[model samples]
Target chain A: MSYIMLSYTDLLLASLLLMINGVLSVIFSLGLLKRLVIAVTRMVVQLLLVGSILSWLFAAPSPFWTLLAAFVMVAFAGYEIVSRQDRPLKGFWSAGLGAGSMTVASMVIVLLALTTQIRPDPWYHPQYMIPILGMILGNTMTGVSLGLNTLTNAVRREAGAIEAGLILGMSRHKAMQGVIRQSLRNGLMPLINAMSVMGLVSLPGMMTGQILAGAAPQEAVKYQILIMFLISGATGFGVIISVLGASLRLSDNRHRLRLDRLASGNGK
Target chain B: MLEIVNLHRPGLSPVSLRIDDGECLALMGPSGSGKSLILRAVADLDPNEGRVRANGDERSQTPAPLWRQKVGFLPAQPGWWGESVGDHIEKSDSVLDLLHKLHLPDESLNWPVSRLSTGETQRLALIRLLAHAPKVLLLDEPTSALDEEARKSVEALLKAQLSNGVSILLTTHDKKQANRLCQRIFHINKGVVTEAFS
Candidate 1:
């Protein structure tokens, strides 16, 4: 193996890879060409901004600024996730709980387990915490959105059964048991599928990134396993807490459903 | 008795109707004649510009869910959401008796709702409604899906349940069933309810 110095050529090569991916995406005509273009453009702009800010922060590292940036990322991601769904964005508490809990839990685990001994600064290291927290928050956003969508649809479709349960002296929680179960199952299925097929079928992003950065294959694999476990656990917690919190918001003090609040897209 | 005042659709005159307790009031009308709307209004399922008083109590005084539980409203088609038949039917003494009256077998409790036929599901839906012991049963084409024999059995079941101080407001296009089942008949034409048969 030979070590090569980083050069402008490397940036050109990365741009070429992006172009090839774009061409292949167009050739496939996957009906997501518009979305792909928008995603790539946004990713480029966001990374450029992040890189510039991070370069400065790393040079003159401020712990408070780094932590604030991570919080902003979580909050922005939470808003985007909730707004993307069919439901209205009246319930911010659930979104906050989901994003804050998962981001904090996973970031703490990554910091304490892997980098605490290795890195000089632990609490708010821009190089370590920003990237790790970003990954965790992104995953949590997906989990929360999926959970909320499934739950809202389930409740809407099963209104009659829920009403029947209410008539039978059952509380709202008891009435919504089936809907809650089905929604949680639907929300968790994607993460479960991903975890089941991991390692053998796919090289996860973290492992691939490490290998490209000249880390040993074994070291990268260990990090990938740890991160995957952390992500899956965080996602589970996020989905469960978000669903429960959102369900509570749907009901009133008397346990009657205030369905008007959760109504989708301009109630008729 | 159930009294409906100012029960009017948009761009139509208000209607008033009063039926005594234990009376079977059959509402007959063509499609889109506001027959089902009347039933929904009584059940408090629809927001309408009117007042409905059931058993001497104004609807506004009673909670909507409590009102709905007392006023059992059956739409043309049953709305099913549970997985198994037993899942939908809560434990009650009258549940098995109502199931038997509707000609459903004891084994129906174990069957999945997906396995139920349209007629069986309709019967089961009626049984489920009656199991709650609603004071007023509002049916919109309750037996429209059934054959002659099933309709007869359901009619008989409704008649049997009338002794328990239950008031039924049934809607149907079948004149013979209406004549056989109702003590009073209200015809809805051009968005107005008129007493046509008694």
Candidate 2:
């Protein structure tokens, strides 16, 4: 089977389908016309730019390029985590915690997968490295962001209860145990749900894309399973690191809840 | 016994005070006068420049959890994290007695925390503190939410604690209540602590 490349004309045909969405917005007075148009435009530009970058990356296949690509993705994810918070930690701590943990978890998992499961030449081959890192980092970033956001908000809301825990003979770690557990659950819940209903509810993105790209169903299933496991590992590691780090940073060794370390109240 | 030497924080004057074994000291101050500040500092819940010694155990040297358990502090509106009263207030043989003493029924232990009245919450917070029986109690208006009769029952509970050699540092705006329970009263205004005449 030959993989037929999508031409610019075929892309234009896809754009026509988006017109149906625009038509509905206009009919219902949903006021989504502007946003829909802008979003679709941005999506097109961004994805095309990414495609161009990947072409360059695949052409050169330098370790330096791969490293730069990974760093850039992680850095953006770090900022996204901070911006998503309702009450983010003050100053550099937010960015540091998110980015630092993401780098640790996503990089480690991707490297392990590359070495042990799919041994590509030079180990940092852009073909495999970029997509795996992208998938892992995307999910891991969400997990870390949700965990940190939920944690800070919960801590702020439960200030009295947490202090009570401290006064009730609980260590700082012990006092934060409940919140940490909840945050971890919040972070990993999506992965859990997705994994449980993987094939029945909806086909996973990688599997669908691989099958669409003419890969055999059996082979595509293998890659999808491997990717899902990689994502799960990355998400768990990422959430734990960020949540634990946030809990520790927001409290002191004295078991006191240092709410002042947080930047103001809720953003909304 | 508890001793605080020159405890100072932002917007608070340096405070030095002592409570003997089985003694009660009252800190009298209006709202925002740093009454809770002093209690928090003594409890090591906040960063402050001070030396707090409880039963010859220096606060800085002891583990924070141990120190807090030793020097228990309750805020004006104690926080309840659990869903039910029993979750916040531990069950014990003495706890049942304390509940009856505070005029709360045994069923209150099963009551949802959200169902508790302000007065009940305050009383239950007291019971929560008493559950561990800290060596020192830094209470911030422990009876502020209670009515006259309820207040009387809480006072009885404190008196029993005192006789058991538990020292207390109570903050209150009610002079009559302070006079009734505290052996010494210190008035605080604008961060200043001066002996108040009974």
Candidate 3:
């Protein structure tokens, strides 16, 4: 069976289904109509731009272009992490800690996988590199940002306890070990919950997309399993690095809690 | 003995003072006059510009953890991180003795920290710091929340610590308590230190 293609008319018909959401907003006075329009418009514009870029990459693949794309993706991921934080760190740390860890984890994990598991003709082929890197960076960004958010908030909340421990001769690492562990948990919780209900409750996104594009169900499932494991590894690595790095930034060489480094207010 | 020379932190003026071995120096100031910041700076808890010496040895010579071990600063509300009060307080023989002296029962250690009254929290905070056997004690309003009887026990406990050669820097609003307990009272206003010879 051949896969069906959507024309402009078909796309417009599908958008009609979304009208129910606007109706509900109006009936309930939820004030979501404005946001709903903004979100949908933004998604269409962004996805179309990405699609055009992907087509161009496929037409002419090169290592430099691939690297540039990867860098841009990670940069945006870092910016998003900073934006999502309720209380971002002061100065360069607002972007440095999360983005640095995410770039390291996603790049290393993707390189390792492309070379060993899913080797295309040229390992850096845009066909393979772009999609894989995009997936890995997206998931890792969520994990890292969530981890950093939790880490910053916890460090602020536990400033007193940390000082108590420090005054008792405990090192900064020892004082913050508990907060780091909890932060890692918060970062990885979404991935864990998704994996726990993978096939039954929710089909993995990559697998659903692959199956729709006419890949065999078995092939899609196999790739889905691999993708799931890869996402988990990347997310786990990113979360640990980001959380530990953020914790270190919250304290100083004197083992004292540097609460001034944090932006004011209890985080959302 | 702890000597702080030209101790300066942000929002506080320069402070220089000395407390000899077994001496209790009372720090009296209005609210928000940086009394707590002075205590914190002396403890090396905040980044500051100053020279703090314990027993004539520079504090910066030692590692931060070890430095903190020798000089303890108890905040107005001591932060308790553990579920039970005992988790933060090591129950050594001296710790038990201090708790008893502060009128906190041995059973109170097992109680969750949320169960402690303000006076109990203050007393327990002192006991926790005393467990370190610090050479210099920076107490921020150590008896502010206590009643007359409890305040007397706390003062008695501090006297015992002082006799054992512990140098104390105390902040209090109680003038009579300062006159009674402190050898010299130093009033801090706008971070300027003036010796009040009573």
Candidate 4:
């Protein structure tokens, strides 16, 4: 089966759908017209940029370009996580630690998947490496952001109860056990729900793309399952690293909570 | 068996005091006199420029959780976590006697904390503190939410703890209750600490 490529005219015709939605947004007084326009515009620009970069990357297939792109993706992801945090860590710590953990965990997972399972002709093959890294980093970034936001808010709201635990001869780890558990649950819940209702409720983007590219249903399903598993593991690892790091950073050695380092009360 | 050295805060003056084993010291002050802040500082729950020694061990030298364990703090409006009361308390036979002493039935342990009244929560919080067998207990109006009878019962329960050599520092607006329980009374107004003339 051959994959059908879209022409520039085909893309232009499809873009009109966004204009129709933007018009409706204004007519309905939803006040989402500005956001809709910006989102659509940004999506087009970002995808075009990524498309150009990938074309160049796949042509050369250099380890340097692949690593550099991966780094940028993770850096952007880290920035997103920090910005989304209600009580973001001070100065560079928020972005630094957040990006560092997500990059390390997502890269390791993607690398292992590539080397052992996919086994691309070259281990650092840009075709497989860049997209895989982007997917893992993107999903993991969302998880880390959700977990950190929930954790910081929970710690603040339940300050009295947490202090009570500490006063009751509990170690810091023990005192924060409930909050940590809740944060992890919050992080993973969306993915878990999606996994549970995947095929019946909605065809996921990857599977839909694969089908559109003329892949057999069975083959597309297999690839989608693998992608789902990879995403789940990456999300868990990202949340664990971020929440643990944030928790430690926000507490003193004496197990005292110091939320003063937070820049804002509400996560953006 | 607890000593506070030069405990200073913005509103509260540099205050120093000591309570021997089996003794209760009361801090009496008007609202907003920084009494609760003083108790919080002694418990190391709040950051303050002060030194607290529990049985000659400095608070700074000890880890916060361990120090707090030794010097337990019960706030005025106690915080309760866990769905059921039993979830917070350790499962022990001694807890039954404690619940009994505090006028709470054994079945109350299994009851949800959400169902507990303000007075019940207050007693249960006091019982929870005593359950830890802390050497020094810092209480903030432990009886404020209780009725006259419940207040007496809580005072009696505290007396039992005192007999076991637990040192206590408490805050109260009720002079009679302070006189009844505390051997020494300190007055605070606008954060200045002074000993009452008895």
**Which model scores highest in DockQ?**
2
lDDT of 2 by residue, A121-215 (tens): 97999999999999999999989989999999899878888888887878888877888889999999988998999999999898989988899
Roughly what TM-score does model 1 have, to 2 decimal places? 0.73
Better of 1 and 2 by lDDT: 2
Candidate 2, A154: how far from true, in Å? 0.9
Number of the top lDDT candidate: 2
Per-candidate clashes come to 0, 0, 0, 1
Write model 4 residue lDDT over A1-268, tens digit each, in one string: 6798999999999988887888888888989998888998899999999999999999988988898988788778887888888777778777876777788779888988899888997899998898778778888888888888888888888877877787676777888888889988998888899899999998988888889989998998998898788888888888898888877776767776667766664434
lDDT at B80 for candidate 4? 71
Supply DockQ values for each candidate. Answer: 0.19, 0.79, 0.71, 0.58
Instruction: Give the range of the ten consecutive residues with the poorest summed lDDT in model 2 chain B.
Output: B189-198
**Model 2: per-residue Cα lDDT over B1-198, one tens digit each:** 999898898888998988999999999878988898888888888888988899999988999999888888888888876798888777888999999999888888999988889999899888898888899999999988899999999999999889999999999989998888989999998888965665
Model 3 chain A worst lDDT window (10 residues): A259-268
Which residue ranges in model 3 land beyond 4 Å of their true spot?
A: A265-268
Q: How far in Å is the alpha carbon of A99 misplaced in model 4?
A: 2.6
Kindly report, for each predicted structure in the order presented, the TM-score of its chain A compared with the true chain A. Answer: 0.81, 0.96, 0.95, 0.94
Badly placed stretches (over 4 Å) of model 1 are: A1-5, A14-42, A61-68, A82-128, A155-172, A193-234, A245-268, B1-19, B44-68, B90-100, B103-111, B186-198
TM-score (chain A only) of candidate 1: 0.81
Q: What's the TM for model 2?
A: 0.96
Per-residue alpha-carbon lDDT of candidate 1 for residues A109-182, written as tens digits (9 for 90 to 100)? 55664464335465566877777667766776787778777887777777776755654435668777887887
RMSD to truth, every model: 5.5, 1.7, 1.8, 2.5
Model 1, position A188: C-alpha lDDT score: 75
lDDT for A185 (candidate 3): 96
Q: How far is candidate 4 from the true structure (C-alpha RMSD, Å)?
A: 2.5
